[model samples]
Target chain A: MSAFAALVRRDLVLAARIGGGGYLSLLFFMVVVALVPFALGPDLNLLSRIGPAILWLAAVMATLIGLDRLFQADEEDGSLDVMLGASLPLELAILAKVLAHWLTTGLPLALCVPLFGLLVALPAEAMAPTALTLLIGTPGLTAIGAVGAALTATMRRGGLILAVIVAPLMVPSLIFGVSAANAAMGGTVPFTTPLAILGAISLVALVTAALAGAAALRGGE
Target chain B: MTATGLAASFWNLANPTRFLALSGRVLPWLAGLAALVTAAGLYMAFFTAPPDYQQGDTVRIMFVHVPSAWLALFLYAMMSLSALGTLVWRHPLADVSQKAAAPIGAAFTLLCLITGALWGKPMWGTYWVWDARLTSVFVLFLIYCGILALWRSIDDPGRAARAVAILTLVGFVNIPIVKFSVDWWNTLHQPASVFRLDGPAIHPTILVPLLVMAVGLSLVAIALHLSGMRTEILNRRVRTLTILQADHPSEGGI
Candidate 1:
């Protein structure tokens, strides 16, 4: 347990010191959210209607930014080899990394969704649900992203490939997240239902993706 | 035979040289059978199957579309099994089978999508809808392409195999989620109409041809897979030979 906590702490510190502590993802999230208004034009009604979806898409994109490097840095510096040789199980190590990633990237992205929601002219009623859904869904995104990162960790330039591979698997979370937000925005279905499903997806992704990512990391070696 | 005997026999064929020899002997016969079956299936589809009461001539496309869709799902299932073999059993040819099967699966998926659109144009008055079934199949196609891209990007076969296998397994786990999400999304938008639980309600005349076409397509897919495995095995042999020659120039002539 200490090793797991230490691993997570180390990753958090590394991300803070090196990857700008989620500031980069925040900037990227803002830029993506900013582009939607320009592309769709100044129509507040349309923006408000699709605001939750836009925020969700932007959150997914932002979460993807530094994922390819999730394991590559360790793999390159030989820490990954040592980690594999450590008394700690590979799956637990992966869970720690994924947890750190969610903290550094997914949590910040979720936190910023309300601000971006305002920029997109999202309805006031939907902002809380959007933020809530994102908070639940983004861990699923980072967890799956960990698997993609591990799969492509050995490749030279595998960022695009990792995105291609991971994006389709993320469709369920995207659907449920948007649905939950829309439900909150006065749709027929209750917000809790889809939100519950989104939470289920995140839990499942956390477990399965950790196992798969560990297998890929070990298999690559 | 006992379970171990069966397992022994299966692994015995997993040997690359043995696979090459066995597939070489079977390829010609399988190719001929595939051609004959497909020709007969096409004949039955065109000549024997009567037009749908509602769809009329447009119903013919189902003969092609349904089979391709079935094969698309079947191929993915086969790939998943092969992935299990690769990762759990470490069978040598398991990765080869998975790699060889991906593009063929993708091709079937594409065919299914195109034919589905063509059928939808007349039936639904639109070429496409975000309907649950159609959307799920589209997602399947995207997944197939992603797997193919993964296979192509990695230069090392062994590493590529393991990576792709892991990815395939992950995708397999998500397939159910994709289907369920698309179904839920569809209910929010519109209900599904393609196929339903109490059976399709298609007539025996149409059903027979559809079955024939489905069998024919399955045979063809199997034949293609066998030939692909053969080519891959031969390619690996060539790579080995070239590496050996490079290491010892004097043995190059042999």
Candidate 2:
């Protein structure tokens, strides 16, 4: 547990020194969100209707861009080998990494989305669900991205390959994320339904990454 | 040969040598079968199948559209199964079978989507809509392309297989979505009558030919798959031998 915590702290420290995954993804997310209103001719109704979707989609893409750096750098530098050599279970190590990932990427994205919600003129009531949806959803992105990153760590041109492979799997998260936001905007269905589905996706992604990551390690060995 | 016998023989021809030989002999027959079945199905569809008062000629598009859709699903199912076989059982031909089936599946999916759009344009007065059924099938196509891209991108053969296999397994989620999308959401697409509570709403004329073409396409797809697996095996063998020759210099280096 200490090892996992230490690894997370180390990663966080490194990120803090060099501007972590969170800042970059948040920057990308805000940039994309900010641009959409301008491109759409500053129509508040149009922006309001589509803002949640743009935020969610951009969050997904930005979170994913940082994912390529998740495991590959450590594995390449033999930091992963040292961890494997240590007493900590790889699964726990992975879980910690995923949490770090969400903390670094997902958390900031979640925090920044509400600000963009205003930029797009989304109703005040819609902000909470949109933020909540992103919070529940980005963990799944990091988890699934872990699997893709691990699998492609040794491959050339891995980023594009990772996106191609992982994006389809992201469909469930995308569906639930968009739905939750739309429901919030529509004022009919409770936002809990899609939030629960998003949680389900995160759990599924966690299990899949652990299993697939194990297989990937075996394949690597 | 009976269907069982043909199926057994195809399995036996799973060996690349036998597969190549058999497909070489049988390609012409399978080609003829596809042509005959499609021509006959088209004829039956136009002249013999009674037009619906509601859908009219647009209903005829279902003849091509539905089968293509079914083929898309069927091919992906088979491909994923083959992927499992490759990963678990290490079937000599299984990976090749899965790899070969992807592009063909994508093509069939493209056909289904195009035909659906053609039918929709006149009926719905639009080229496309994000209806549930349509969206799900569209996702299916994306999955197919994704599998293909993963298979091609990785240079390492074993790693590529695992990558594609894992993705294929994950992408199977689209199947249920495609199947139940209409039920899950109220869309411009009609509710299921052909595969549901009441069972088969269409008349016999339409049903029979649709079945025929469906069977015919599956057979042709299998034949094509067998031929493709044979080519892949040969290609792998050539690659392996070349790598071996490169690693240890032969007496004649060339």
Candidate 3:
């Protein structure tokens, strides 16, 4: 238990010190949302309508922010080798890393969705739900992205392959997140329906991604 | 008793030399059958199948479209099993199976998409619809591309096999989600009329060719895979020999 906490804490401390972890995704989230208006022409109504989807898409892209370096950094510095030999199981250690990663990268981005909602001219009623979905969905995105990260942990340029590899895996998260957020806006479907599914996806992703990432890490050795 | 015997025989074939020798004799027969069956299937598809009352000539596209679609999905199933082979059993042939199947899967996916589009143009009056079924297929194609890219990027065979095996497993898990989510996202698409059998009448004219084409394409796929595995094994031997030759300049490698 302490070892897991320590791994999580160690990752958090490293992310905080790195400064590259959180803000890059936050900034990306803002940039992508900010660009949508320019691309679509500053139609406030349009922005409000597609706000949830735009936020969701940006959130998905943002989730990929630090993933390439997730395991690569550890792999490069040889800490990964040490971790492999540690009393802590690699899957648990990876789960901790993913948890820490979601905290620094996904959580921050999700929390800021409401604030960035202003940029998209998102409706007041929809903001909370959209942000809520992003909050829930981003964790799954990070977990799925982590598997890609572990696969390319030893590669020189993993970022290019990372998005391609991760994108297809992210379909369920995107579908559920966007639909759930849209559900909040008002429709025959209740908000809780897709939201529940989204939560389930997050839970599944957390388990599966950790196992997969650990497999990649061990297999690479 | 038979099950254990079958399992024993299966394991014995894991030796690449034995696999190669076995496949070598089977290849000609497999290739011939594939060619013969595919020709028969195509002939049946194009010539025998009646034009649909609703769709007329465009219904012929289903013959091509549906079978490729089946192969696209079926190939993934085979790849998933092979991925299990690579990861759980560490079968050398499994990775070769996976590597060879990706391109074939990709080709089938591309065919499915193109023929789907061709069918859509006449029936739906549009070449593409951002429908649930189409989107999932697109995602499947992308997954194949991603796997192929991953395989190429890694140089070490053993490591690449493991990494890609893990990736293939992830994809296998995700594909169902992709299919389900897309189905939820758009239930309005995939017109019932287009499928023909959805109309409460199962016509033998349509059923026979579709099944034959499916079996034919599958055989073609298997033949390609067997030959591909053979080539891969020989390639690995060459690679090993070259590496050994590099080690000792004075002495030639076997």
Instruction: Give the TM-score ranking, best first.
Output: 1, 3, 2
Candidate 3 CAPRI level: high
Q: Candidates' TM-scores?
A: 0.95, 0.91, 0.94
Residue-by-residue lDDT tens digits, candidate 3, B78-192: 8999999999988768988988888898899999999989988878899987777788888899999999999889988889888888888888865564445444565534533
lDDT of each: 0.86, 0.82, 0.86
Interface RMSD of each: 0.8, 1.7, 0.6
Q: A-chain TM-score in candidate 3?
A: 0.97
How do the residues A50-118 of candidate 3 rate in per-residue lDDT, one tens digit apiece? Answer: 889999899888887668999999899999999988899999999999999889888888788779989
User: Which clashing pairs does model 1 show?
Assistant: none
Instruction: Estimate, for each residue in A66-109, the C-alpha lDDT of model 1 and write its tens digit.
Output: 89999988998899988988898999999999999889888988
When candidate 2 is compared with the true two-chain complex, its DockQ is: 0.55
DockQ for every model, please.
0.80, 0.55, 0.83
Q: List runs of model 2 lying over 4 Å from the truth.
A: A86-89, B1-28, B251-254
Which sections of candidate 3 miss by over 4 Å?
Answer: B1-8, B174-201
Residue A95 accuracy (lDDT) in model 2: 81
True contacts kept of each: 0.79, 0.41, 0.79
